[model samples]
Target: MAEQGSGGNVIAALCCVFFPGLGQLVQGRILAALVFAIVAFGGYALWFFIVPAIIGFIAHVWSILDAAKFRRLS
Candidate 1:
C-alpha cells in the first residue's frame, strides 16, 4: 500500500469536503470516484423529498473520510 499521511492525501480530503468524489479522483481511484459522484449527487437531487436526502449527507461525509484514509497499492 502507498504510504500514509502524505500532503496529497490532505489535499484529496479537502477536495472531498467540497465534492464527494473529487478526492477519490485525486487519489487515482477512478471507479470509486465515479460511484461516489453518482451516488452522492443522486441522493442530493432527491433531497427535496427529505428522507433519502440524509443518504446524501452520509455519503458526503463518508467520501471525505474515505479519501482521507485511502491507500494506493504498490
Candidate 2:
C-alpha cells in the first residue's frame, strides 16, 4: 500500500464507510480484517443493548482510521 493520506488510503478509508474491516482487507491485512469484522459485526449483532451498539460504532470508526493511517514497513 502507499503512504498515509495517499489515494489508496483514501479509497481504503472510504471502503470502511460501507463495512468495517473492508478497508483493511483492501489493504491486504487479512487478520486485521477478520478481527475488525468479528468485533464490529459481533457487537452489532447485539444491538438490543446500548453498550454493545456503542462498542460496535467505535470499532467501525477505529477500523476506518486504522486503514487510513496504515503504513507498510519498509
Candidate 3:
C-alpha cells in the first residue's frame, strides 16, 4: 500500500521546509501547525541562526511522520 496522505504530506512537508505552517495547512492540521509556524517564524525573525533552522527541520520531519501516520488512520 502506498499511503493515504503521502502526496499531501510530502507537499506539505516541502512547503513547511520552504515556509512553514503551509505543510500543516496541506495536512489539514490547521491550528497546531499554524501556531507552530508562527512561533518558529517569529523566533527566526529575531534569531535566524540556529533556532529557526531547527524549528523548520522539526516541522519537516513532523510532516513526513504525520504523512506516514495518516496511512494508519484512513
Q: Estimate each model's TM-score.
A: 0.89, 0.96, 0.58
* Residue pairs with backbone atoms closer than 3 Å in model 1 (clashes): none
Model 3, residue 60: distance off in Å is 6.7
Residue-wise C-alpha lDDT for candidate 2, range 1-74, written one tens digit per residue = 76989989999999998999999999999999999999899889999997998899999999999999999988
- Could you tell me how far off, in angstroms, the CA of residue 31 lies in candidate 3 after the best superposition? 0.4
Model number with the top TM-score: 2
**C-alpha lDDT of candidate 2 relative to the true structure:** 0.93
lDDT (Cα, tens digit) per residue for candidate 1, span 1-74: 26566788889989999999999998888998998888889889998988668888888889988888877776
Q: Per-residue alpha-carbon lDDT of model 3 for 1-74, expressed as tens digits?
A: 23655665567656766666666666677885777677766656656577776775665556545543454345
Best by lDDT: 2
lDDT of each: 0.86, 0.93, 0.61
Give the Cα-based TM-score of candidate 1 against the true structure: 0.89
**Higher-ranked by lDDT: 1 or 2:** 2
